[model samples]
Target: MGDERGMTRMLLECSLSDKLCVVREQQYEVIIVPTLLVGIFLILLGVILWLFIRGQRGQDRRPAVRGTAPTPPSRALSGEGAGHGENVCVPLKETSVESFLRATTPDLAKLQVPREQISEDLEKIHNGSCGAIYRAKLNTGDPAKSKSVVLKTLKEPAGLQEVQDFLGRIQFYQHLGKHRNLVQLEGCCTERLPLYMVLEDVAQGDLLSFLWTCRRDVMTMDGLLYDLTEKQVYHIGKQVLLALEFLQEKHLFHGDVAARNIVIQSDLTAKLCGLGLAYEIHARGAISPTRAVPLKWLAPERLLLRPAGIKGDVYGAPPYPEVPPTSILQHLQRGKTMKRPSSCTQTMYSIMKSCWRWNEDNRPSPRELYLRLEAAAKTADDKAVLQVPELVVPELYAAVAGITVESLSYNYSVL
Candidate 1:
């Protein structure tokens, strides 16, 4: 009986030991799982905080780049009725590029100008908008018919630099005053809604029309001073050169000198009209491609994606092709290409060639062109005289009905 009792006691001890081992294992598993879960949660929270901080810092840097459209005060009060008083001035819709060009008075005009200066003449021109231009009469010492003037009002939207440019032009005119080649600003009034500038009215209009007329029809001698003669062309070329020289002497660049910006008076005197596109020599180096000016009449360095320097004017030139006699004959033939003329109008062709050289550096400076033209004007022996042969530029001839090289005869009487 004693032996059996001892065995039962041993068995009981074994069962208790097993239970203790199983309990220890379960406790260890529970503790490890909780620690791992806590570690994962801490990592996720840290990542979220880092992303939030970085996003906020980015937002603070460039507010404009964040896709937020700035609301102008003008747009906010649009369509709010006639009951609004004069004191409650609201902003207008964002000024467009076209309206800026055509409008006689722009919205910015109000910001800079005072109320008293506003006049009926200040109404917008219904044209493209780059700036506001006002037409006013100037005291030319004759009260009977006061000389008409054009005033360009410049007000920048958000760009302070552009405003500075407008101011600089004002100073430029204020100091230099008027020149025949320049559009004369008789006076300026920046007091209120419509800034005032008094400038000569170019009744003859812009340069583009002049070029087109010359290209299409035979210019009337009553209005034109020069014919298609090389000497005449050379003289005209010289006049342009002199204008360019005057600008260069002042250390200014007419950055945009295309056919469109030039204006011809009744006397056939050409004036460079648009000063808004003009830039000082100092700013040329840093001028962005966005502001690099247009492609027409541009130096190749300015055209071919090359870096433009002060020496840029000396490089990249456009190649000018003269009216080919074959082109003339083709016109005569109702638009069929003809044989290239041997050498009749070579001088005239040469002028075009020089004007259109590929390298600006190789191109003649205005001074050089002026000198050449002046020389050609005086001397019969001038090798530069282009003889418009019976077969002139055929391409030009082919384009026009009833026009041919044979149809054109140089009559000194016309001159």
Candidate 2:
């Protein structure tokens, strides 16, 4: 009886000890898991804090508005209804590139080009205020296929503001997407400094230069004689109006529309190019006061700092090509407007006069202009080239333009 009781007591004690051991193991595992979770959570929190701080620093370093006091970030956005006319203002904040990139999701994979793929020459075709432009060939993956592209790059050792604006412009094109009447972005090499915005090469260059070429007795681009008949002028004008219509669809407008901004392909296809001010006006709610627009091209409301309508660019540049730019605003203020050119038909001159109305409201809408152009184009002879008898040189052209030779852009090559 004594042995049985002792065995039972010992077994009971062993069972209790095993249970205790199991409890202790369970407690240890619970403690370890909580501790590991806490450690991981701390690491994640630190990473988030670091990113937040970095972003704050970037915002702090953003440059001030070019010609006015920097406004708060929450400026009013454009509205579709009655507020459309007043949507745009001036002195836009120069938004930073990285933050803008984060805000807008661009397909970097398609846009980012490797530096080695581009083959360029020593000669720069044109020197711009910010950088030099080169005519280069981009090597596609296929050995047989290569693309002729225009590489617009910044000046060496570019300043921070310049770099930011330059990259921001590239993103602006991405936002606009592709349009037949607008220059399309091919790709960009913006990963590092010495940034490049690759654009499809326009064989004939800007329309203004092409117009200057037309003044010569003979001019040809790839054997197509350069001449602008009254009907052909309507055709080109019609295409530009289409681009403006596209902008209207996107709740955007091109403020500085001129011959200088339109680039021509070999087949007389016009693609609108200058979009710096337009980018500012659309991306931000305003534009820089320092943005250079010829007074002749500016709407009256723009000069007076009133809210200009979207139809501002649709009218085409004010017709006083011979007037001194400095004297333009004064003349406009006195109610003087453009005189009709001799080459301008009564219908085209009437169209030009409609754009020159002192009051923005008095001007016809883009649709009206488009209809007129369409009606005129039906009767226009596509093959009949308008011929000019004079051979114009820079000096003679400048004398007629009432501007000094230095004032004229001579980067263009003559035919």
Candidate 3:
């Protein structure tokens, strides 16, 4: 009985010790599992922060893109990169006229007239400072649809600078687009020497010649007498103002504005021409005083060598003057006060006089001049306006005699 009791006690002790070992193992597992889980979470959070910082740095290295459209790739037309390796990029020092026109006017291809397709009439029209003008016919694919065009040829053997200038003018005209008051450019031929610019033919010649014709003859046209009335003057002035306003909006000014530069159509439409000076002014940002401006048509401040602004072209009086060119030059050189034309009506005279203000700021803007002329036109009678005869100087009448409308149609070419 003593041996049995001793063995039972020993077994009880062993069972209690096994129970305690199992409890200790369970406690160690609970503590170690939570600690391992927290370590894994901390490592994952550190990795996420590193990734976010890297993404922010990438964004900072590149410029932000704007605009609704994607930017086009820079194209190198000429110079090193042209016809070179695909990866090469070249920078252009200057923009070529061809490239400029292509960029600004995508329809330039349609406006181009092939040099071989043009046939000239051989008659020279008006000889101006730029070049001689001639009439030509463009051979469209359809014979009936072919139209007569004015060809202004550049004087042969033009220097590189001259050629560039001519091209710049063409591009500017393209930029101006088409308007009834402005002369339209059909196309240009720059492939060969003596580059020719094709323009639309205005049926009636320049206003100066037309006015001269009317003064010479008590002209009967379409069974009615053609006369220059005060109202008619207003009419002509209004059209010119419209043209000026158009140019002003484009940041341009007609440096030379006179009857000689105005082309009149059969329907009495006046279109402004002589864009060479205007283009020069635009390129230079202001008119140079050294230019040979028509003294009689220039305002006093302009004669004194002041830089020309939009108001520079406000004076478009008839070229025929009571004062001789030499005398006018002398008077201007002497700084003598100039007088307004006596032939103009009080209202017309007043308007022109205001344009001649010594201070350019005092002169009326093109828009203001347009409004004043429009108001004057409303008060005048059409029939009475028609009754008044067109006035021209006697010398102009004698000079322009026998130069009929038919003769003018075939004359003059432009470059």
Candidate 4:
């Protein structure tokens, strides 16, 4: 009877301390749910923020002009390409030849000129290090209108890297859009190993050859006089400057700027060529020591293998424009300078002197140089052809032009 009475009392009476414990338990349950929800939300927000930051960094890695081929990475991959005082663009890198072909196949298909349509002239083929440059005629599929194109092709049995490097140059051309003063990339044949980069033929050959011809008597080719005047030099020079400005705007500097690189049409349309070094520095961040760019033409920085400089030109046609960049530095350091011709007026000479300054910073910017050229052009006499005293003989001409007399291909009549 006593035990039953105690149990009934325990069941009926609730202590204030016990009630407080039950309320604490309910508070913990409510607090735990809200805390867990808040933690999950914070984690989700952090993940979203991290993704956004990653996406932004990806966008920042792209090249300046969006070229067709991505060669390799150096300054461009780190997003550090910006803030270069006169730098125009930052080029990116690529993975493999297969991937490059896969990415470029769709676009390259349109650019591929049918090899069947291109008639290769065996006699005019100029073999290069990796391939032969052919003066071929593209049929345009139309027998009536055969387009003359220069075919820069890779030799068969080429390895992967050689093919990629060739394609990189093609992509570099695509990177450099259409500019009047620059040679135009008409089409290409990059479907397989024997890749052909088709460039529009500037029939006048190179500017140095044209100048050498001018040194002799005024010759008639295609019923037109191929002569150069002071005014014409400015005209050609201004055009070349426009090309340089175009490159400068893209953050590329033509390390070797001279007459040999510029090709003039009969109408005096000077198109700049030999951009292999420019593309090399643009893609690789350094010039190849084995390149053909003249030593006297390059700044001291490029000579010492230091960081390349901006702003670089022509005159009494450089005595030895063939001296490669490797040897030119010492020639430059020893204070050997090119002759300042009478027709190569003081203004233009000033520009040349400014470019040859030992210090890179001391050189004029491309814009400043262009401005000076334009100012000088305003006063130039476009009609009077500048006459340079003829070299005593053809051998002297060959020596000055850096070519052997045996290699000179004169027309049948001239011969």
User: Which candidate ranks first by lDDT, i.e. highest?
Assistant: 2
For candidate 3, lDDT tens digit of each residue in 1-415? 9999998786656653587657867899999999999999999999999999999998677442211211111111002222233322231222443454445344456666787677644446654344557776888878898788787765432344455666777877888989899899999876444466899888777886676566544444434346667778788878988998899888888877877678898778899988777887777776555556555667656666766667878853333344565355455445344455445566766776677565678879888998998887787655543332555434443233322233232222210
TM-score per candidate:
0.51, 0.69, 0.63, 0.65
The weakest ten consecutive residues by lDDT in model 1 span 406-415
Scored by TM-score, the top model is: 2
| Residue lDDT tens for model 2, 254-303 | 88787767888888899987787778877678888776666667887886
Point out the higher-scoring one by TM-score: 2 or 4: 2
Tell me the lDDT of candidate 2. 0.69
| Tens-place lDDT digits, model 1, residues 1-415 | 9999997776556653587657867899999999999999999999999999999998567322111222222221121232232332222323442244334234234223332332334323212122544454455455775556565544323122343445455556655545667766655554322233445667655644444444333433234322334454555455556666777776665655544456667666777755544445444434544543433335555555665432344232221234332243223234222233453245544544565555456667767766766766674232332333333343453244222333222111122
Model 3, residue 229: displacement in angstroms?
A: 3.2
lDDT of each: 0.47, 0.69, 0.64, 0.65
Where is model 2 poorest over a 10-residue stretch in terms of lDDT?
A: 71-80
The TM-score of predicted model 1 comes to: 0.51
Model 4: lDDT to the true structure: 0.65
Candidate 3's TM-score reads: 0.63
Candidate 4 Cα RMSD after full superposition onto the native fold (Å): 13.0
